[model samples]
Every structure is written in C-alpha cells, then in structure tokens.
Target: MTEQPDSVVNDPNNYKLSYRKLILPVSLISAGAISFAIPPMKELDLSAKIEVAHDRPGKTTLDNYTQYFPAVMVYGLNLAGIKGKHGFKDRTIIYATSQLISAAIVTPAKSLIAEERPDGSNKKSFPSGHAATAFSTAHFMYREYRDNNLLLSLSGYPFAAFTGVYRVLNNKHWMTDVVAGAGVGILSTELAYWLYPKMNTLISGKKKNNKSVVVPYYQSKGVGMSYLLVF
Candidate 1:
C-alpha cells in the first residue's frame, strides 16, 4: 500500500511562500512614502544654486558612464539566466513603472523649478533623470537578487552611489538633484513591488523541491573518462 502524506503537510502555515510574500508590497509602500516626503525640503534649493554657479564643461564623460550602466547591468543579468526567472519579471515591472514615474516627475519638475543645470546653462535642471534611473534600477536589482546572494545586494550600493557622483561630476545636476533622484528611484521600486500582487499573479507561484545530478566527461591521449555527481 502507498503511504499517505502527513497532515502537517496540509497545514495552513506549512506552505512555501515566494519572496514577494514579504518584500514586494512592503517595498512599494515604503517607496511611495519616501517619494512623497522628499520634495519639500528647503535646503535643496540653496545647494542647487551653488552647484550651478560652480559648474564647468568636459564632464560629459561621467554622464555617459552613468547613462550606460543600467543597460549593461540589465544585459549582464540576462546573460546569467537570472532574468525571466526568480523575480525577474517582477523586477522588470518595477523598472518600467519607475521609469515612467521618474520621467513624469522629473521633466515637469525641472521645467517648473527652473533651477539652472550645474553646467550653468538653461533652467532645465532639478532632480537628475540619470541619477533617478540609476537608483531605480539599483533598487530593483537589490530587491530581486539580494535574496539570491549577499554579494548582489552589496553590488547595488556602489552603482547607486556612482550614479549620483556622475550627475554631480558632469555638472548636470546639484547635490539636491541627485538626492531627490535617488529618492525617486527607491520610491518607484517600492511602488512596483506593492502593486505586483494585484497587477500579476504569476509572481505568486511557489516552487517545488527537487534535486539534480551532473556528469562530466574528459578525453585525453585518445582515452575518454567520465564522472558523475549528485546534488
């Protein structure tokens, strides 16, 4: 006779949960709160003015680096086969929503603030878009991949920091702009995570426990050898 599964297996608390169970909605709400709170600080205006006055040229290189890093990171993740699995889809949703929100907020805010760029050019600078994008992407990576390994979580900080640095170095934005941008990125990621539950149910699926084995083969001096291992 076949053995019956234990009653504990069907217990409500015994089911496996996805990473989204805790992280997704919480992150979203947190991002929203931060985004709402950052815009009214008075010190940002003073710092922005100082940065614009001292701005110089030839710093476009930093801007270039900042602009391309997100694309590179996305490509790297894809190559690692991490995308489309293990919260990849959720991350993509976060990125897309963040991008949209950043663009919507930054463009209009820049125009309205009329805060001159660090380059001292026209008044189209307030909250650096590049910095915002970088932060958003970094936050997404952190939330999605941090659970996979600690190194991935650690890697996000440097990228987010550099994005702010590049904006300042390029003289395209002030310290205030970079700070606000960072806030925007973080907020966007959190919003995405929060909305994920209602937006898509695929993210809620649970994985089954399984095991795998691998075998290796080598050829030398016209002889072949093979080895097997189980995981």
Candidate 2:
C-alpha cells in the first residue's frame, strides 16, 4: 500500500515518497516557475498588481490574523474531539518543521532577490512570507484531516486563499510573489511530511532530554516565549 502523509512510521528504513502526494506541490511550483519565466505570465503579474491598486480597496490588517487560521483550526478541532491524523507531539513537530522549512527558504530568498514590495515598503518581497505561512499551515491541516473529512479538510483553503489575495490587495506583494510563496509553502509541508518519519525515528532513538517548561508571556504589543530548564 502507498504510504500516506499522515502515517506514523517510527522506522527511518520505511521512509519513502508517495508520488500521488506530489501533485499539489509540483503543480504549484511549476505554475510559479512559469509565472516567473514566461513573458505573458510576467505581464499578467504586473497587470494584476496595477488592477488591484486601481481599485483602491482600503487595506486592512485582517490578513495578519487570518493567515494562521488554518493552523489554529487544526489544533482547535483536535481539541474539540475531532481527532486528526497524528497525535499531539507528532502533529506539533510536523507543523513546526513545516514552518521552519518555509522560513528558511523564504528568508534567504528575500535577501538574495531583494524584490521591492508593491507599496515600496522594502526589498524583502520576492516571495510573500505571510502567504507562504498561510499555505503551509493550510496544507498541514489538509494532510491531517483529508482522509476522514474531505470537506473539513478543504475548509482551510479559502482562508489560505484570502491570505494570499490580501497580500497583493494590501500592496505587500505582487501576484507572482504570492504564487511563488504558495508553491514554497506547499513544498515545505510536503518535505516536512516526508522527513517527519525519519526525524521521529532519530528522536525516539535518543535518550530522554532534560526537562523544561515553556511559558508564554504577553507583553505590550507582542507575545514572548521563555523556557525554564529543569535539572
């Protein structure tokens, strides 16, 4: 049988790719590459930016909060007894890995490409990190719930879509930037899914680590995380 993305394999020897699962990430990446390489598509990207700018829609900070809705839903649903594919630790690790991978890819690319934002804010705009984060979490939610509830699994996409669209609408990114970010995000999650089993094996094989407590602190305008090491 083909290995499912949500399958928990504690053995690194069982690590394998499921080609069927590659469709979404591959198609997105291909589309992104085409958008970057093809003249007509590049024109489309510019036209899209211009058209949206012309609309003069009032920019809102909604995207900031909504981008993480899918990931939040994953945990919320699981907590409410709508069990997902993996248990708490496994799902958390997978989600964290996906976020890490997406950040690692997007951060360096932003520095290297230095594409300016539509609003002329800065040059860290080749790929929309917000869109990338949205799609990565959306894909993570989908992978966890796809087999059981297809509709519910897909519910996160509209939010993800909105996040990407708003990145352009808010003049924070170009259409092509959002497209590339979506591709990168999905690819990140895909890689996380593939690597998680191997990672789990390695982690499980190790001796228990020292205990620690993570405390979340709310500050003036942001949240802070601190850890207490236990000997």
Candidate 3:
C-alpha cells in the first residue's frame, strides 16, 4: 500500500477552493447592496409603520452604549475563567483588527453615501454605526465562545439585534441601514479571521519561500497569523 504524502494532505496551498464556503457572506452582502438599487427596499412601508411606535419605554437613557456590551461580555467571560477559541494574544489581535476594519469600512462609506438620518440629525445614515459595532462585537463573542458554550455564543446575536432595533426605534437609522451595517460587521470579522493567520506568519518573520502554513504563536516574541480582509 502506498502512503499518502504529508505535504499533499497537510499543505494550505493544496486545499481545494470551495464556493460553498462563500455562499452565506456573499448572500448577505448582496442583499445589502441590492437594497440600494431596488425600489421596494426603500419602500419598506412596514419599517416606517413600526417606527411610529418609537421610544424604548423602559430602557436606559444611555441606550446607545448598549452596542458595546457584547464586546464587554466577551472579555468578562474570559476573566470569569471561561476559555475561548483563542488565547489572550490571538483574541486581542483578531478582535482589535475586526473593529479596525469595521471602522475603516463604515467611516469612509458614511462620508461617501451621506444619507440623512431618520430624525434629520445629519447625513451619515446610510449604514448604522451602532449596528456595525454591535454585530462585530457579537461575531467576536460568537467565534470565541461557540466551541465552549453554545448558549453563551448564541446569546450575542440577540444583543446585537436589539442594538439594531434600538437604532431604528430611536429614529437614528433606517431598516436598510441596519441590514447593511450587519453585513459590514459580519464581513469584517470573517475577513479578520482569514487575514490573521497570514498576518501572524508575516509579522513573525516565518516566511520560508512564502510557503509556511500560518500558525498562531503561543509564547512571547513568537510570530502569529496575518488577518485576511476578504469581503
């Protein structure tokens, strides 16, 4: 019997590219982009009708701050002796890079689109920043705790959804804006995951003919992965 070559089985370069892996993210981003061109998307009469019942009756006056709660919960859980998917260094880099990428996408798009807010506050309402932060944080929490505690991992989404809902209820953003923001947030985190592996290798000076399989470092002064920013 012939033994299979280790390089053939274990090489990252040998991995088969699959379109199935891209379906979810592509569909989500497409939904967001298509909303801009389609008539009925802007004509979301249902959302407009719901907006009339506005103002969170019992929620705190500082409701906008709720968007950051998911991220806080991630660290809180870590401090509470919960082991996440990554260690301190990997998680820190991945989470921070995710947020950084989100800011990059949201800020420039906001300036370019310049859509007016629901309450006529300003023209930076095309994509909801609160929703972006909420979802990105939620995804971070989800990725971290998912393998350890499914319930805790799933809990992040509701918090993120609530933030988006609050944004709409408070007349800060439109429904489409919320949807697009969600897409951006999710995509940002996914991109970070892809990039971190490569970035780690690059930063660690571990490129031998540029063919090394990227790995996360576990010790001080060790190299980590580079984050891929794929949309």
Candidate 4:
C-alpha cells in the first residue's frame, strides 16, 4: 500500500477536470464547428481569393514533408536533452492514438460531406488530411515539452500553420477545410492526453518502487528470462 500526498491528490494537472483548463481547447473546437455550420462560412469566398492570389503552376512538394515535421521535432527535442511531460512509452502511445483518432474522424467526414477540392481534383476534400496531420503533431509537441521550454514547445504551431497555408496554396483544400482540420487535429491530441492515464493503467499498473523485474519461464526445453523495465 502507498499513501497519497496531499499535494499529489490536489494537483489540477493530474486530473485536468477544471473549466479553466478546458476553455481554450473547447473554444477551438466550437469555433470550428460553428464556422463550418454557419451561412457566411458555407458561402465563403476565401479559398477562391487565395487561389487567385498565389496560384502557381508547380505542385507543392514541400508540404508533404512539412506536415510530419512537428512530430519529428518532438523526438529531436527528447534526444537533445530536453525533458517532456511523459516518457517514451506514454508519448509513443499518445502520439499513435492521436493520429488514429484524427484519421478516423477525418476519413468519415470527407466521405459523408464529399466537398469538392479547390482544384477540382476530387469530392473528398472537406477537411485536409495534411492539415490534420500537421496540427496533431503540433499539439503533440506542445503537450510534451511545454513545461520544460515554452518557446520550443510553441515552435510546432508555426510549422503546422505553414502546412495549412501550403495546402490552400497548393489548391488542395479551402480555408474552411484547413480550419476544421486544425480543430479536429487539436481535439484528437487533447483526447489522447486525457486518455493517457487510463491507458497507462490498463497497459501496465501504476509505477512501483521496484520498477525493474526479471522473470524466468521454462517450457519443455525452452527457457527464457523476460526483463521488464518501467520508468
């Protein structure tokens, strides 16, 4: 048995159940939802304006690489001696889950809405997948290292924003599509963070004093010792 300290029990960071903490994230989602539903946004001419402003003949190849840059930066930061909120296992799980959630939401929305692309490529361009990927990575980086380095943590958003811009410039998605994708991406990461603790409990029990264990098993002529380490 272990005794919980008062500070640990009362820590708002642990539960994340406060209205103050949720206001910004919820606002992001609500803004996207309201904008997507409203008449002004429905008949918005911003996408055409952008295409007319920056329409070029060449294809945008850089955006494909930039979309995943934020996620790579998180690992780079960890390798460069910057500490994040969670360790390798938790971060991996959260990142993977966030991408999955983003995909699940984006895929069906595209199919159901069937919005036409800016360049008349296809009818499945309501929310930009590149935008979703970029923002998800941005939020993932933000959640991980915000405590250690605020500026570095914030660096991901610019890249994500650039990705959205490129998507519009490339005539792949509209401004509304990018905005909705950003909201979906942010919400996915937020949901992943909220679900992390529960996932940790289900995958492995709470941290223990002796976090390293080696157990041996033998089955007919086969024997092996499994080494388990938790940090």
lDDT of each: 0.53, 0.75, 0.66, 0.69
lDDT of 4 by residue, 13-77 (tens): 65364566456656655555565568776556464545556655566778877877888888666
lDDT of 1 by residue, 1-231 (tens): 221111111232322344555364345334433433677443554565565557744555555455436535653665556542233343444455555665666677666767776567778666666666677667666665565665765566577787677677666666666777677666655665555544435533432221121211111111122332212
- What TM-score does each of the candidates earn? 0.59, 0.81, 0.74, 0.75
Question: Which one wins by lDDT: 2 or 4?
Answer: 2
Question: Which lDDT tens digits does candidate 3 get at residues 2-111?
Answer: 21111111244322334653466556656655767887877782467365455345534344666767777876676666767765455655776777777777777887
Residue 5, model 1, lDDT: 18
lDDT of 3 at 30: 67
**Residue clash pairs of candidate 4:** none
Ten-residue stretch with the least lDDT total in model 4? 1-10
The best candidate by TM-score is: 2
* Clash count of each predicted structure: 3, 0, 16, 0
Query: Which 10 consecutive positions of candidate 3 have the poorest summed lDDT?
Result: 1-10
Residue-wise C-alpha lDDT for candidate 2, range 15-99, written one tens digit per residue: 3567766777677756765765689987888899889978958998888877789988987787677888876556766777787
- How well does candidate 1 score on lDDT at residue 141? 68
After superposition of all CA atoms, the RMSD between model 4 and the true structure is: 9.9
Can you list the residue pairs that collide in candidate 1?
27-190, 28-190, 28-191
Model 2 lDDT at residue 222 = 30
Better of 2 and 4 by TM-score: 2
